[model samples]
Target: MYLRLMYLSSLINIILSFNITDYLYRYEYFDQSETTTTKLESALIKFQEFYNLQVDGTLNNDTIELMSRPRCGVSENPSEFYTYGNKWTKNQLFWYFAMADATMLKIANRVFDIWQNYTNLNFIYSIKNPDIIISFSDNIFVHKNNPRCMKGECLFPFDGKSGVLAHAFAPRQNKCIEIHLDKGEDWYIGFNKTPLAQTSLFKVLLHEVGHTLGIKHSSDPTSIMYAFYSENTDHLSKDDIEAIQYLYGKRKESSTTNTSTTTPASTTPATNTTNETNKTKEIKLDLCDIWTNKF
Candidate 1:
């Protein structure tokens, strides 16, 4: 009996080690080539340091819990230095929805407004030749002709429901800026009424939009740019504000007047075009029913 219990304990440790290693590799803590024991510990330590967790180089309960939480698909920076040296040269940027409904459009407008409130940048809704394009999909196939999937045939395909809620591309010269949300997620619009299992479209959009503007993930958990999603956080933290301002100087005093309005842009209905049309309809029926009833 004693030997059996010891064997079970060893099995559990092995499983936990595998999970931690996969998590580190997935989030860019380290590369697959450097999969030695020391490298794994170092990567774990780096991840802990980023989240302000105790750096004991061990997979404690806290680390495992944090790892399981929903987070942006974008990988966290491996270094202390923030900002990827990528920023839009133009102040006026046009964005369009390749796949979204009226409700989603409204939420996006509010998100863009939040960013505009801080920087000199301006976001406009355009139907054609938009600088940023947003979409919802369960699986993103790589198109060799497409710059967005430059790395390979499949760039971080969505794994359904929880793990990665969304991901976006930073500004790049001659490359398209894109944001893709997992259609499988139970996405709610507002802060007050979000169900425990549902993700706030507002918060996710707020974070992805930051990425569209070339803002990288922040180590500060309070910041919207933080890799992991937090239900309690509704607005940008100081780190978020500073990061945006650093890329594009603060909003001018005269421009303090709120020019952008939360007007829903005419966008392609998600149910009308994508392969996930049926799924999108089901999501709207379930979530929007509650949304309409509340307001």
Candidate 2:
């Protein structure tokens, strides 16, 4: 597979949470081939399309930088991620979403977008039963209604120094995904934070969203899900993109989601032109894929 995204060398220091050597372990007994690499390349292109960037897999740092900008909603504070306490009155997961800020809305859209890219999965967020919930104050957050982690994970989206950016629960067997909103209190919904002279909110959101969609962290430094968040880095690495498309490509049984009479279902069709010929059919994409880059 051709690594389409552009790549730029960086002086930024990154610490790895997961060892790169593990991939070598997977590669040792695992079948590694251009076919797999191409699959990875395909995933990257899907993400590029989601972010409205050029469909290149070269890990272009410039493109990643551009990707950090607002795609879903504009922010007043515009910084990377922040840490704030999740001071909520109720224990219900939906309470956090009720108080979602512009940053949170953008993050939600990004999450939806990644899921939308995989046509076969056809997963959509039910505003009637939204899959993600967020409790944000500064960078720390508590989430619930998670498919896997049941009680939800306690996390920080942007704890300074790239120590801990964020985390997410896996897609549940019910075929739904649970993503929690987390960031620092000082972190801007946009890029207003002091450290983000150059960085992206959407970039981090995209990465976390990828995790919700089943993308594991990648060894490719350029990948959005790389263990470390780099300064001025945005956009999914070629490997990151490939990982998503391939994983979600399998068709799960059709699932119908109920929408609130007030909110109504958000029916976003897929953007994969390859499937356009089957006009009578529908392809589901992550809401992030359909609308984030526009914001």
Candidate 3:
């Protein structure tokens, strides 16, 4: 069944000037396929459900435009099994560095701290085997059994050549929770200081870590878990906080909290794109086909 789908997709790609593979790699939202059958149709339906799109399987202008948008690594496939069960069983989680430099480690710690500040969930750094493993790899095919990854790739390579940023696995189910970053990208500590720069390290990790905690992407563009990266995004939106809290109840209030980060009011902003078709092309983060790339 998979081989048949691939052959048909290959033929369709040859006929079309636009590369659907590249689109899927960047977004990592829906399964990328050329054949317009039920497989593609079902994937599209899942995409619409994940993003609150109208559920027509046929590709429309809106679906295509949304695909062009930036997003996180969590695949929209509803069938994938994830083990984020019963509110984590405990509030504490230990993490390890599979491979990281000083800079990546620093930013990773900061990301963990940021998440901790909001919820009762706590992240502790460990040298031993950890529940969550973080690493940077130029090798796209590294992890195949990672169930958290969605399937697809662009004809143009992902590394420094194209848009895939990074991806992560859902927690509890895998032997070790994992986050794989594309080594091809030039990463910066904070926001992109210049237009010619690479992806933001802090922002990208925040999105991926959310996946490790069982939180999925939200339809809200301002959400940290939104499938794409938005320039204005700096802090977690109310939706992000609410979703995480929903999984594991709200954080207990503390005195003398950190003042550097300001929490947004619980109300969500009204300016995000509605169900209507979006005409603008979105610059999105890209990822690899974890299984296919390995083979």
Candidate 4:
């Protein structure tokens, strides 16, 4: 009787701990119809691989911790991995801030400039007939109350302070691209402060701008487009530059304008003046002490 009771207790514990299936389903890792054990394991493995976690196909402590960390509301499934359906056809894209503080707007502009430095795209700030619109919601209920969120325009409703930071829609012809941030999060501008509970507006906006450009979440954790939010990263990684450039060719260089340099399509000696200036810019941006454990 004692042995039977112990076995039953262990089984109960295992069943209770297997709570990640719902998360898997929500993130497009699992289909409702294919919830068999083999399928579940497959989904777990896929998720682990994307996040560079151990591929044991089990809901380990590290996996649970990662899930608990705040991330973008965008789905990390393979179906929409690198680039979403179509890239924007035009080179010049206009953006408008439907809702944002002056600080947020400034940081957003910087983020847009960073992206344009590496891609053949120009982002113009305008309120009239904007291609992309950005806004913030106080909470999930703001969607039901706001008219702009109606007619399939709303993103997955944000989950309070720290679960989901923000989300953005990919480019669609004639449809305004939307990027919604969670106002509940404590947003900050600079990277000088360490161990801050605040989310970096620059990082989040940079990631969402990638989405608006029709680039999807990157599996590389070092990339700004990584689904999960981390303060450790400030600039774009090689994967991020490659993914964006793949969609919109490299920015055309002008003799008078200094622009950020990206990874070349082929290996070349870094002896050019342009490359030296870009290297200097990157070094300046890395002056902050990155608090990796905060996330």
Q: Worst lDDT window (10 residues) for model 2?
A: 270-279
Question: What lDDT tens digits, residue by residue, belong to model 3 across residues 1-295?
Answer: 8746644553554346446544443345454554455556666676777667778975776676566443444554444432244346677777754434334455566787777777778777654446676666554444423344333431222333224567787666434666776666656544334233346767888888888888776677788877676656767889888778777777778622433222111111121111222233332213232222222
Model 3 CA deviation exceeding 4 Å by range: 1-62, 78-87, 141-160, 191-194, 254-295
Tell me model 1's lDDT, rounded to 2 decimals.
0.73
Which candidate leads in lDDT?
1
Whole-model lDDT per candidate: 0.73, 0.39, 0.57, 0.69
Models 1 onward score TM values of: 0.79, 0.43, 0.62, 0.75
Question: How would the candidate models be sorted by TM-score, starting from the highest?
Answer: 1, 4, 3, 2
Error of 1 at 110 (Å): 0.6
TM-score of 3: 0.62
Q: How many backbone clashes does candidate 3 have?
A: 12
Q: Which stretches of candidate 4 lie over 4 Å from their true place?
A: 1-19, 79-81, 141-155, 254-295
Per-residue C-alpha lDDT of model 1 across residues 151-194, encoded as one tens digit per residue:
44347788777778899888976555678888778777543557
Off by over 4 Å in 2: 1-98, 122-125, 137-142, 145-149, 152-162, 175-185, 191-199, 250-295
TM-score leader: 1
